[model samples]
Target chain A: MTETSGFLTSNGMAIDLTDLTIDKAHKHLKSRDFSAMELADAYLEVIEKKNPEINAYLEIYDDVKKQAQQAQEIFESKEENIVTGIPLAIKDNILIKGKQASAASKILEGYTATYTATAAHKLIEKGAVFLGRANMDEFAMGSSTETSAFGVTKNPRDLSRVPGGSSGGSAAAVAMGGALAALGSDTGGSIRQPASFCGCIGLKPTYGTVSRYGLMAMGSSLDVIGPITKTVADAEIIFKAICGKDKYDSTSISGSINAVSPKKEYIIGIPREILEIEGIDKDVKENFEASIKKFESLGFKTKEISLSNIAYALASYYILMPAEVSSNLARFDGVKYGLHKKGANLLEDYLNTRGEGFGVEARRRILLGTYVLSAGYYDAYYNKANDVRRLIADDFENVFKNVDIIITPTTPTPAFKIGEKVNDPLSMYLADIFTVTANIVGIPALSIPSGAVIREEKELPLGLQLMAPHRGEHSLFMVGSQFLGE
Target chain B: MITRTDIEKLASLARIRLSEKEKSLFPEEINSVLGYVEQIKNADASNAKALQKETVYNVMREDINPDESGVHTKDIVDEFPKKEGNYLKVKNIL
Candidate 1:
């Protein structure tokens, strides 16, 4: 109920940016409590005050006021939808036509999107005001935002700590009150881990629910576009708007896949093998147990289940993800869009352009991918990884039949210090241990703020992840809303 | 283990030019990563079915010209790094 004083309209109607949710704002806008222009100005004021320190937004769109003006017109015409005038921060990887989407890598610097992504286009159709493009790890590769060519996005809670990536800025922008919600792509824990680190709700819907036509491809098989929001209901609102079949992306499924009715009670499955993994923070484990107890107290039953191939999920992800990255990124040669460097010959042109444009981590992944897919090692590395991926998927398939949902800690630890895992890539990869399985199995996963743990005298947020069967987003929302008391 | 020579070959195959510093450092870094993921080799996946085995199917759509298709061909062409008129100019393949 705390409201910032300066965000008042001419009629003295005050807007509360700190406690504003999509539904609240929609009701307020419909009742003429405040105009959409006023709402956007309020967020712009906060971003102006906070972004320099937080480094959450890479670019604040020049057309925000124009977009807000259009949204106000919709309100006047009484045609405003739920998302009309709701300001959102888009990850740099998801394109909006005429906007620059770099994916936080120099490789695609100055690249203007010729076409908007299906998800962003959906938001545009709903009259959502795009606040800005948020920063992320270059090409959505690193778990920490430190890999961004622009800069690392600091966690709003503690300026010294990282906002976990590769959707770090999207999460930070929401946490810092810059945007109501944001869109982020999860290849492996990109959206959920960052949301967990920044104390927000992030949902990665089933792999085919959201179209990937314009999301910068990282891992084609694993990548998904989802919402990062302040509340579970807000996340569901954005997901409903964006999820559906698209002729543009053949993999997209109909939105009706979420039409399943909510049950009276739900069963929560806990993977014993994942919790037994090494290097999980003591506090995170404790927080997860507390969350299970909270769910149990709410009449949800918890059962311990074993996923035999869960141990290899991360390894499978690392191999399969990089292999896909190598193939997808091959389009960034000198002749096409994005940064280009000229050389004496065609071969040298490709080498020079890619070498100079890509960051160290990007190059490293490309090389790793190339090595795995190489002729001699193809069967040994790439094929073997695929087989393990199948096994991991099978493990989830069998488990879902016994339980309605699975739960785990979103990340092994809360947000680490900005530079804690930068020099060590392996350590950074470990951050996705609990999150990668959802991506590997192509299921819907939701990460909600469980509670906070005090670290260094600052309260750092922790999150618990709930994963449902394929296209089981309704169950996730039902349990998530009950858990968050929304 | 990935050697420096192997790193060079990968960089070459990937069409990326790595500096000598990268060449020297990547062997160790890639080896560590490969070492971690190498555990999958021991996984027994004989009973597991291939991904997309039943799901893989061609999605056919009627072909349409760029003008009729609603695709912004001009915008796509405008993104080319080096363009001569409407055609993208690339280095000679021969």
Candidate 2:
């Protein structure tokens, strides 16, 4: 799309997807300026060169050349919509018929899709190129991409550091310019945190806004599929295209983009309790203040809102999400079609497959979920957590009743080094504290790259988040885009 | 507060072989998290009946009746750790 049109090299290999925006490529191709095959060949060269270091993709669709040949005909005929043969990456959790939908897990290691995931189908119908399956956490269960049965996906910004997860590869691909835009499923900060860590924009549309029919289930109530893009506008455009009712997914909502608040000023609520956690990174706090100052400058009124249940969000999320994840993922045990190992009987095969398939982090959550939902402990844990989930939701509902939007740091800190917190599961889960509430309350939230913080060990961007009532994404987008100085 | 034994038992039930190294790390983590859940144990949830759990059902549509879901079996076989002719190769079952 840019002057460096052909394949280029980054991270020691050829990267064809870099600088490949939908707008630039289409404009040139439609005007008889360039051919689609040439563009595909250019990217193929790049992928061949740069894929070793960035390993963002799991399967590189070799037949893409044929698809490009077809698209070239359309471009020659002078018809190119918003996406016409634009190369894009789909997270492995979502199925694209005929492509392997492993979710990067060993159990379902090579399973191909019988039905294409809804979002991928829509993107394909619009002429978006399916580059390949991107790597992700096994079953979309962990925050860091490390949990992926596939090896870790490094941050394109800094090779040694992580890209963030469970949609880490999706964010890294977009950040490293490997893909124009990537569709990632976010549940408890998966999309937003990785985007922040990689210095890109991640939008978690209102729950049920995007269909999740084929997305590998993590927390069914919390999981949402949204785009991780370089700019908020691109994120908004992608959100608009894939959102709406789908017969395949009953969770899909009839969310309207037109419920945009036109007020010149908005009341923004900041809960002080969330900010008080120890080890809250200094740079994130500073960027948050500066971001708030900018919002105030834009005529937004700020208040320190008191919603007492904030302290318990992380606890409630761990309990409730794992319970849902445990139930949703129960079907993946060997017999149905994920992983199968030979055993003297069916039981050993099921146990071995799951044992080998899931990562430590995933195993921990599954165990916790199984415990909480077990017969004796149901009232003490799961039922009580659900009760608390209500309290947290009520807190947000009441807060939104008085204010138009709520803002917080999308994550407590920027991306830590690859192994910094992986050894400690609680610390890793705590990293999601700022984001878990949006899922718990079922509200729309957006995370925009606020500013970069360069620590001695690492330099990554911090995210300033804006949350709105359910179906209030337009306002969240407006405020987030406004804060990012769009 | 969840004890180390509780974390260990949960780990065992979940079937992840938590080495002593990890076992030591979780007691504190689980407790700190459960401490937060304890507060929610006291929230007024009389009206939370519907908001907490919604019964979900699969919406099955008329089959495409194409005999198969259209997935290639080759790709699926190739992804296993090890494989044989049209089969997944693994450790002996018996």
Candidate 3:
């Protein structure tokens, strides 16, 4: 057997799985340097070797070989595309027909999807292979994958630390060389935060840009299916495949909305107020400053702008996200699908099924959501949060007039050690501060690997977030590609 | 501040049976969350109603079966906790 990057291929040939991006893999597959089966086997080999320690995948799909064979046929027929043979990890919340999609909760333990999510379906149509369902926070609730019933997903960079949630598994899989790329859902920074921690490129497409037909809904207004990959170009490839209007989701807009041309010289906006926030990590701040200087050196102009309502973004999101979550997740009763428990009566059945099925974080959010939406508090909390949401949207609208993009550190700090903030929920929620406003305002945001810092003899990766106006994913892709020198 | 009584009420409304440990622990934990989110009270939302009015619109579609009838019926029916001959069996409300 030969060795490449210290990894061996199944056919006694050397292939570096760590260096393979979607584009590079497509080129290699096109040239017949290696077959699709070899690529899939290389990744599967890595998953078998590393997934036990990382806990990145909850279930490795049984049909991977079959899928690779189909991709091989496409290459033989000369009908292959960029993702024709790419092995991808899908987060647990996304559905592929007849596959178990548990959202990393016991509630959906045995539930099989009756239909495929539009995004995953698009990727499958393009001949991508499904590796498995990646682990995530239950109902996409927690900032760390610690809330998942399966297990916590540790960062590949440092085994002691968490690979940020709720798309922790997706990010970790790519970071650990287990998959070329993965699909993840972002609701309140779920995708971006984890990408930051794992140093992958995560793109939360413009809200309603990608169809959410078969996705397990968390917050209807905030959820968007996105891609986590090694490069911004890979993310763009996946985004283009999945985004468009669909009859199933009425919120999905037509393709013309995102058809804007790229600008010659883009102006970037930096929110100065973010630096004033408490608990801003020193490395994160220094890395952000260096990123700004790097952008300036690349001939892009930077302006100090203000998002006045941004300070209220995290607070507003807590109220609004849970409010939608309580309503969206109410469908998980025992009478339908998922886990069921016998009790004295119908009410007890729901109570037992939901109570025992949902983890502590899910229960907390449900209670918090119920409290805010209940009588006597609805006007004060729920209604007020909506008002603040409108103001945040307005703040974005006002800022986009002055600049083409807004930049921030994806998280306040790099990946924290697992179990470090589990007991303290508020501190865990603080991890989402910089990444939430994009969701709050329904804009597209991308997290690119900015730099890293040494922590406890391990170099932990950090990310910089770039947000654009609604349907302005073009700007994000343009700047992101330039920033990463891709 | 959230009290134990409020937590009980919320748990009941949410249809979650909290254990004694949760009942003891949730008050402080939830209070911390609510206390942190309490900062939203400072936002000047006088124009919030106007902003809300601007974005509200009904999305309507022609009522037609997008897929073949019964294409997903069997799969959905197979998942029922209690089922009888294509019918979902549930506890009698009465």
Which number leads on DockQ?
Answer: 3
The reply for model 2, stretches above 4 Å from the true place, is A1-21, A41-46, A77-79, B1-39, B42-94
lDDT of 2 by residue, B1-94 (tens): 5677887777556544466765776677656655655666666667777665454577667867534653556655555545667776554545
- lDDT score, candidate 3, position A396: 88
DockQ each: 0.74, 0.29, 0.81
> Given candidate 3, what's the lDDT at residue B51?
73
In candidate 3, what are the lDDT values of residues A1-486, reduced to their tens digit?
012455444545577776677888899889887888888888888889889999999999999999999999999999988889899999999999989999999999989998899999999998999999999999898888999999899899899999999999999999999888999999999999999999899999999999999999999999999999999999999888889998889888786645656788899999978988999999899999999999999999999999888999999899989999999989999788999988889999999999999999999999989988989889889899988999989888999999999999999999999999999999999999999999989999999999999999999898999999888888999999999999
Give candidate 1 regions above 4 Å deviation: A1-5, B50-53, B66-71
The lDDT per prediction is: 0.91, 0.76, 0.91
For residues A196-302, write the lDDT of model 2, one tens digit per residue.
88888888988888899888888998999999887777787788878888887878877457565566777899876777887798878888888878879988899
Query: Model 3 compared with the native: what TM-score?
Result: 0.97
Instruction: Please tell me what DockQ candidate 1 reaches.
Output: 0.74
Model 1, C-alpha of A78: deviation from truth (Å)? 1.2
Provide TM-scores for the models.
0.98, 0.86, 0.97
